[model samples]
Target: MPELKLAIDAMGGDNGPSVVIEALINSLKQDTTTQFVVVGDEAILSSLFSQFELSDHPQVTLVHAEQVVEMTDKPGATMRQKPQSSMRVALDMHAHGEVDGVVSGGNTGALMAQAYFILKPIPGVLRPALMAALPNMTGGRSYLLDLGANPSCDSETLFQFGVMGSVAARVLESDKNVSVALLNMGEEELKGNDEVRNAAQLLGQSEHVNYIGFIEGNHLFSGRADVIVCDGFVGNIALKSCEGLATLIIDELKASLTSHWLYSWFFKFLQKRTKKSWQRLKPDHYNGASLIGLRGVVVKSHGSANATAFESAISHAIKEASHRLPEKIQDRVESVLLEQH
Candidate 1:
């Protein structure tokens, strides 16, 4: 009856089914029209559902999965070995007409591989990218793609990511003229490697994309670009480094403010003032990464996501689904590719 239905991999992440169930339980309250097909151990999920008083919730349904994909499992191995995993089951459901999208907090590699095999990439998409949203200084968000999907990419692949990412960003932002940039070593034209330089050339020649040239690491969160593109190797390292730095900054601030007994009271006061600022830096608030260019909406959550974080992942899937993101991206990518011919 509900137009939006999502398959959730309940047993995917570090904390297990409880977090996913809890997020689903809370989500049901806010959005009654959305249906949830939760995949995991039946016994464990039943208990969790009962514990959260969601046992008979009309919108929720539980589907059992025999095997659980581990964090360390190789992508290709998991695909061959575990066919009945929660992640696999969810993806299977999405690939078919059963569910509109999938949200999983499981092994990223396994999820990607399984999704590639099951859902497959949309026509004209070279490779699907792991695109994440970062809070920018301009009170908005910037999208960075190929976070860890493909470590190396050619100029054509990199150029495709820009087209796909811009379409992806349009789903969230109201603006169609989203700025695209290449994450480079420097702003200078000759600073980066061959792949990046060639990609820049392709992007600049494109009339479809609003190419903004190059963006340095320092300007990643400065709102210089709406969609930033790079190969997985550089993007993954840069993203992780930013996350690590954000954590360290928060830890240092907390330590400094509450180190002495005299400062404890003042620290508490300062914390209230800085809570909003800290939230922007924390990964918990923005835990979902869209696997763009896929035939279906598949959101990858942080492995260690809590209930709040997992809820954000679910929301990401729903938002993308509502916008018909894959179709929009396909249209844009085809338009760009056609112009080059």
Candidate 2:
């Protein structure tokens, strides 16, 4: 627990600064060694601080931002019109080495755009990809990348994602025997369109990656691979679809258990056990997607994430920053590219 510093975009997210402020309290409790610079409007943050009774938290500081990027804001427009935005300011802080990492539950497009412009990509990385750990059947997790960073990536870009993701899995998962797989329509060599097949070929030829062939979306949690690669277009849809389905199932189970005539001690007991079991796989509650392959660490939390979940995003930033992930990815990518040449 070294004295780590991170910047927070306090005014992002659908829940706005209130959730970020509460999350800061929770995060501070979880990691005493981390210092936070919460960026947003000064007066509003001050009011929230007073309300939370965290106005005197020595580890937390406030930085004022003049503009707030809305969920509806276009990335290009936001960049030009909202130069002083909380998202931009937080990234600026990270770029300038004022903070080791940044956490934001902001406009995904805007945040990604700002992050790419401010932090830039590692030298050999074609483009920065977003990666998050998803629960797998073996009770372990796999890292999925290109979570909407580049919705339409080329063969080479997809290939680079595989290399980047493989390095990331090894570093973040702390597992040297990590496996990489391309998400496809089928697990055959001839499956998928040109880019996917080409990327698979690239990964297969690379000694740097442990190419495990293709993995269909259904086997995402089967522990077939430790690192799953896909273009952002497919990855985003798959991730959200899975999340939506999980939420639906959990809600339905709760409703049925509470409303049924068999709602007795037995039913209550089942619900309790089920909830505990499902808590570990709850994607919405504590998921944080990191924008990887960038020069600095930037974690993107769901815009609707609660205090606990956002707190997890803060921890995610700390972990990646502490690991010097960007540098590691750079080294891996450089080696992989040189081998190709």
Candidate 3:
């Protein structure tokens, strides 16, 4: 097996290196073969090391990064002005072939902007979009594209999302017929305005995409569609709304059930048995979203991701990198573009 080196941004998330370090430890504890290059200020990492005990395993390395880019800073400005920032440092490692993959729990916009500019996309891909897996009860999970990449996309972009998403679906589940659908207000042809109509036509005629026709908001979680395509504006709303509803449900159950004496006692018992399972189901645990179409794997995690989330993100990146998803995506996109030509 070729040695895989991962560059992680230690100071990108809300909890800074604390959670990121915790996550790295979690992953490293499980497997010693995986090596990590954590990029951040040397002093802060040194201080935190004394607090948390890293195993005697010597696979982890720390790369000194003097600058830190906040989530609020402009991507272009930060890249040009603060070249040595944590985000830039990690990306530079990948650009210069020092690392095979990069992962960050940081500003989504800046991550996307910096990656697109620095790493660039595969040969045939026009744009890079975000791909996330939504938990589904019936099957393993469903993929939704353009999660937060472009607020507004054209018909061509929508078609591209379908192709990308379908490719992901195939990679995730072999022999499973991947169904693609355009997210819209209604299933009818005349439902949405011009954008929906044009996108629908493009998807409907796509040879690369499964192109199952239009799907409404309600069908997203119904497990009817394996790959859902939409603009980032709509996709972001759907993703956030899904997370919000899941959180609300969990909160309401805890609040209402714990109030009663009998229920409270049972809840305590249940918590002891099911706490780990419940925590695993939380949306934050799966923080990373692969910025699809890049020549290399670039995973973006939530800004507020915790240690467990960061670990999961890193593991996910390793899985994707090992699979060489970028190369697979290149083949699929190039084939589709050739047929178009």
Which candidate should be chosen as best, given lDDT against the real structure? 1
In candidate 1, residue 317 scores what lDDT? 91
Using TM-score, rank the candidates from best to worst.
Answer: 1, 2, 3
Candidate 1: tens digits of C-alpha lDDT, residues 1-341: 34899999999899988888888877887887888999999998888888887788888899999899999888899987998999988998988879999999999998888888899999999999999989889978899999999999999999999999998898877655799999999998998999999999999999988998999999999999999999999999999998798789879987887899778888888878989887786677778999999899999999999999999899989989988898998898889878988
Model 2: lDDT equals 0.88
Give lDDT for model 3: 0.82
Position 327, candidate 3: lDDT = 82
Candidate with better lDDT, 1 vs 2: 1
Residue pairs of candidate 1 with colliding backbone atoms: none
**Which regions of candidate 3 deviate over 4 angstroms?**
49-56, 172-177, 270-280
Q: Pick the candidate with the highest TM-score.
A: 1
Lowest lDDT 10-residue stretch of candidate 2: 277-286
Between candidates 2 and 3, name the one with more favorable lDDT: 2
lDDT of 1 at 35: 87
Stretches of candidate 1 off by over 4 Å are none
RMSD in Å for all candidates = 1.5, 2.0, 2.5
Cα lDDT of candidate 1 equals 0.90
